[model samples]
Target: MAKQDRAVRTRTALIESAAALFDSEGYELASLSTISERAGVSSGALHFHFTSKAALAEAVGQAAVQRLEGITRPQVDDALQALIDVTHALVRALDDDVVLRAGFGLSDSIERVRVAAGLRDKWQGWVEDSLGQADREGALASEGAAQDAATALVAVTAGLETLGRQDEWWLSHAPLTRFWQLILPRLAEPSRLDVLVASGSKGGAPGL
Candidate 1:
C-alpha cells in the first residue's frame, strides 16, 4: 500500500512539473531532464512512471480532462444559467491552473499527434450541448440561435484563454461579465434574460 501511494505521489509530481514546464515553454522545448529536476525525481523514477515525454504529456492532458469533467459534471436548474457559470469557471481555471493552460496549449500544438481530443475541442463540444439544452428548455430567443451562440461562445472563450496567457486581465471576471451581459440579452428569451446572472451563479460555478 505504501509503495503504491508513493508511486501515485511521484507520478502526480512529475505531471505537475511537466505541466508547468509545458505552460512556460512549448512541448518541444520542455525537456525530460528538466521535468524530472522540477519534479524532484530521479530520471529513473520518471522513466518508471512515463517512458517518454509524449507519454507524460498525455498524462497531463488526461489529468486536465478529469478537472474539466468535474467542472461540467454539476448541473444547475436552468440550462442557460449553467452555461454562463461554466464559461466563468473555465476562464478562471485557465487563468489559475497551469495544468489547464498547458493542457489547452497542448491541444494547439501541431507537433503533437495526440491520442485524445484537445481541450478546446472538449470545451466547444460542451458549450454546444449546453446551448442545445437551453434551446430545448425554451430559454433561447429562436430556433437556430443555439448553433450561432455556440460558435461565438467557443471563439470568445478560446480567444480569452489564448490572450490570458500573456495578460491575465483577459480572463478576469470583468471581461466575461461584460461578454455575458452583451450576448445573454440577445440569446435568451426576454423572460429568461431577467433571471440570468451575467457574472455567474449567485454562489459560484458548480463543482468548484
Candidate 2:
C-alpha cells in the first residue's frame, strides 16, 4: 500500500513538473530529464511511468481535460449566465493552473499528435450547447443569434487565451467582463439583460 501511494505521488509530481515546463517552454523544448529533475524524481522513474515524451504529454492533456470537464459539467438555472460564469472560471483556471495552461498549449502544439482532441474543441462544444439551451429557453434576443454568439464567444475566448500566454492582463476577469458587458445586451433579451451579471455570478462555481 505504501509503495502504491508513493508511486502515485511520484506520477503526480512528474505530471505537474512536466506541465510547468511545458507551460513555460514549448513542448518541443521541454525535456523529460528536466521534468524529472523538477519533480525530484529519477529519470528511471519517469520512464517507468511514461515510456516517451508523447505519452507524458498525453497524460498531461488528459489531466487538463478532467479539469475542464469539471468546470463545464455543472447544471445551472440560467444557461446564458452559466456560459458567462464558465468563461470567468475558465479564464481564471487558465491564469492560475499550470496543468490547464500546459494542456491548452499542448492541445495546439505539434506534440499533440498522440492526444485525442484539444481542449478548445471541448470548450467550443460546451459553448454551443449552452447557447442552444439559452435559445430554447427564450433567453436570446433573436432566433438565429445563438450560432453567431457562440462563434463570437469562442473566438474572443480563444483570443484571450492566446494573448494571455504573453501578458497576464489578458487572463484577468476585466477583459472578459468587458466583453460580456458589450455583447450581452445585443445577445440577450432586454428583460433578461438587467438580471444577468456580465462580471459573472458568485453563487455557482466556487472559483469564479
RMSD of each: 1.5, 1.3
lDDT tens string, model 1, 1-208?
A: 9999999999999999999999998899999999999999999999999989989998898888888887775357788999898888888888888887788888865355262346778888899999999999999998899999999999999899888988999989899899999998789999987788898986547533
lDDT of 1: 0.86
What is candidate 2's lDDT per residue for 21-115, written digit by digit as tens?
A: 98898889999999999999999999999999888989898899889998886546899999999889999898999998888888876445345
Give the lDDT of residue 114 in candidate 2.
42
TM-score of structure candidate 1:
0.95
Model 1 worst lDDT window (10 residues)? 108-117
Which regions in candidate 2 have their CA more than 4 angstroms from the true location? Answer: 110-113
What TM-score against the true fold does each predicted structure earn? Answer: 0.95, 0.96
Top candidate when judged by TM-score against the true structure: 2
Supply the TM-score for candidate 2. 0.96
